[model samples]
Target: MRKIIWLASYPKSGNTWMRVLLTNYLRNSATPVDINKLEGGPIASARLWFDEWVGVEAAELDDNVIERLRPGVYRCMAGETHDTLYMKVHDAWGRTDRGEALFPADVTAGVVYIVRNPLDMAMSCAHHWGVDIDTAAESMCDPTFATSRSLGGLSDQLRQSMLSWSGHVQSWLDESGLPVHVVRYEDLLAAPAATFGGVVRFCGLPFDAARVGKAVAFSDFSELQRQEREKGFRERSLRAPGSFFRRGQAGAWREELPPELVNRLIAAHGEMMKRFGYTTHQGGNDNVD
Candidate 1:
């Protein structure tokens, strides 16, 4: 069977950036595929590789029936052939139904889970969704927050979205026997060559140091932001242009978030937040002096 490599993460946690990197690195992948229009593209497309709820929806006709048909959906997403398929997924496995996690017959060879700071994720999401920081903080722990890719709006959407983040991260982390390689978004940003090298090696693909370097250099926040603004690729989002890459550096929340809100996120997901190496209180510098 051909191998399937899924780039998985919580929403707003840099899955697209990883996709950009993988699309550039993978031998078979050329041109970054638009996630929204993936179904009928050159790459046999499906959202099975995405987050839990999304996989459920993609697998079933009705969103409410996601859990029932999730396994079938993942199988379909993998399609008939097993040629190496590099896919991007935002939903976390631990957060999704167990049936959903059982997809990709070879777990060890197929998963790349990226973890980012919840605080920064919250900030990025708020900017992307046009909401306040507090709402974004709460959404991190709620399973219902509608990511850019999620369909249908429910009454408890906010709560669901928030809970999903924790569930998703924990899901991938809990899988001990699988071939899951956890990548920290912070490390990827700080050291693209080394971090992405791990991804290249994991996929059994040849690592072109120069090309990988070229891709990383080209995929920087400024360049991506420029592309989004002038190229109109990301203009459709509710967020302002350039906001897509707002503060790509970690801990921006420390500088941008209000003191009270920072404390709130810390209290909410503080322990989980530290798993990614994010300090809750910004090293005792609470005052915005």
Candidate 2:
């Protein structure tokens, strides 16, 4: 059986964009693949998959119980799939309360970890989560940060522990035993051909320069925004104020984020930011300096 490859990233970090590109490239159809119909594979935290595999309603179980069952769920999913499955994940690479890895290592083949500047991420995340930028930034630093944690009603997806922006990135980069291909969102924007080509290579797919170019063009930001405008994107959160594909530009935080809020994010995620070449306005030095 082909192993499962993870399309892992923090929320609002270009995971969908990568999915779009891959779908276009793989399909190689005469027309651009429908934004809604793209076969981007299953999300790691879908409650339906968990319920189906575990033979119990995930909504009835406590979060800890669900967390403990996650590795088995993934193993079963991987075991059933005949082809390489590219599953999208937002959960940090960490262990459950019982010391079990959230994502089972034996089932994983590799990972394509997408990373974006937290400054831009803050603005997008705020829009996505229906919160202010300050609130979004604070949540990115909160160690216990998670999505779908509400007990009031069942969510479509399972609980995803983000464990802070810095923590999330470090968790995946540091602990995922499988081979990892890191893709910076900025690089993908700046050099689509080279950057995405590298991703294709990392995935062990046959290289075709022309196909890569077409995929890049097919998944253009404007096209995605246009599709969202015309047909409406299902991935868009109901809480989002505007289109899900709003302002798909790098470094948008410069204008969207205030100086103080920017400083706060820089202070919280300084070392990681510096490592990823995101410099603060305060003379390219972290607050820790």
Candidate 3:
């Protein structure tokens, strides 16, 4: 049976980039896998997958009903696969309204949690969600923040509760059921080889430096941007007019975020920022470039 390994992250936090690298590495293709064709595995929230498993349309079910059934859906998925399946998830680690674990331990192998600086995340999220940086920053702090809860029609995916940025990070890191490997997006950018090699090792996959190098090169930001420009990326939000792979720079927040917004984010997330080596106004080794 294939054990499920979750590629968990906040939105706009390089989750897709990691998936691309893993897909390339796994396929060992002579040519880079098409950006849209890269298969890390199915998203946990895909409505069709849930509907197929439940024998009923997910769109017709109440959110609470769907939440209650999620653990079973994942358990069934885990049994169906013959190899380790790396699935992407944006839901915070928490329980359903009925008090069941959102992701049952019996079905999970481990998790690779990718986190980015909230300051940078705010800017990228603003572009991705077609909102102002200030709005994005506010959403990051909103404990009830979520996506894919459309009332007018069914969303392509299921509802994913973020539970605030800090809460989301803490929930996974603190959960004891699964071994979690944390990857800082900035660290991945600074040292792709070392960082991704660690990820491969964590996933119990043998590391080949040459293979890692090629995967990194193939999935480089420039290449992703090029592909999006040539053929539009499906994952690109309809709300955003530009490509999904907008500026992938690490510290673009410095240029994009207003001073007041930066301060607000710093104040809201100061403790977690300190824990992750992000320099707040009060100051601790400034890791941001």
Candidate 4:
């Protein structure tokens, strides 16, 4: 069986940019993969297809029954796709109780985990949803946040999904035997060719400099934001464009983030944030450039 490559991430953590990069790269190549509609819902489309069956006609069942149905469903779903299936999954690594069984057991590959600085991620999330920065920050820290799987219902679910990009990214880093390429969003934004060239190599596809250029051209935040502003792409489900693409640069958070709050976030996740070369202190935001 050909490998299934899952581009996994916490929401608003640069998954869309990764998809754009991959889709752009594959479109100009002979890669056999379907650019299917990425489904979003209460239970992620991946979780629904891989773990449970839900449709217009829904059936409630016990966990054991859901477990029993997964393999057959996965086999059917995988068989429907062509050679290699590149699916985008937003669920965190620890969200599902089914362990590795939540995905196709025969998955030949793991994922390309895309990470962003939490500070930047918070700002991005705020702008995307038109929420206040503190609301966005709270969403990251609040376990009760329903949308993110990393959020705990009442307590911490793995980590607070809204504020837990470090934990989310680290989970993939710790997984062994899986080819995990950690790509930073800021790096991609800074230099598309080198960053996306790495992704192209990881996907085992022939790299074309032109394709990288095309990806960069399309992935540009300004262009995307303009398109969204003019065409109302944000309202469309299949291609919902928004301020999510706002400020793809690394340290825009410094200018946008209040000093006290920045210190708080730094204190909360400073150690792991430093791991990705982000600064929690008040200084020049030229960490990645």
lDDT of 2 at 56: 87
Residues 1-289, model 3: lDDT tens digits: 7788999999999999999999989988888889898675689988888988999887787788889998999988888888888999999988999888998888788999999988888988888889887888899999999988735435788888887898899999996467899999999999998999999999988889999999988989998988889998988888885789988878888778888887787877888887777874554236464
lDDT of 1 by residue, 1-289 (tens): 4546767677677777777666655433434434323321122123323334253334224443443444454555456545666655554443234444434454225677888877667778777767777777777766655453325532212112224566667766775245778888888878888998888888787778887877676567776666666555532344543356566787676677787776776676666666666663544253211
RMSD of 4: 6.0
| Local accuracy of candidate 4 as per-residue lDDT tens digits, 157-273 | 112222255555655566334568888777887787899899888888887887787767765666556655655443223222344445567767767888666666666666667
RMSD to native, candidate 2: 2.4
For all candidates in order, the CA lDDT equals: 0.58, 0.86, 0.86, 0.58
**Model 2: which ten-residue window has the lowest total lDDT?**
280-289
Question: lDDT by residue for model 2 over 223-274, one digit each (tens)?
Answer: 9988988999987887889989988888777678888888788778878887
Estimate the TM-score of every prediction: 0.74, 0.95, 0.96, 0.73
C-alpha RMSD by candidate, in order: 5.6, 2.4, 1.6, 6.0
Largest TM-score belongs to which candidate? 3
Candidate 4 — which residues are off by over 4 angstroms? 29-75, 98-101, 142-163, 175-177, 234-242, 280-289
Which residue ranges in model 2 land beyond 4 Å of their true spot?
A: 280-289
Which portions of model 3 show Cα errors greater than 4 Å? 280-289
Task: Name the lDDT value of residue 172 in candidate 1.
Answer: 68
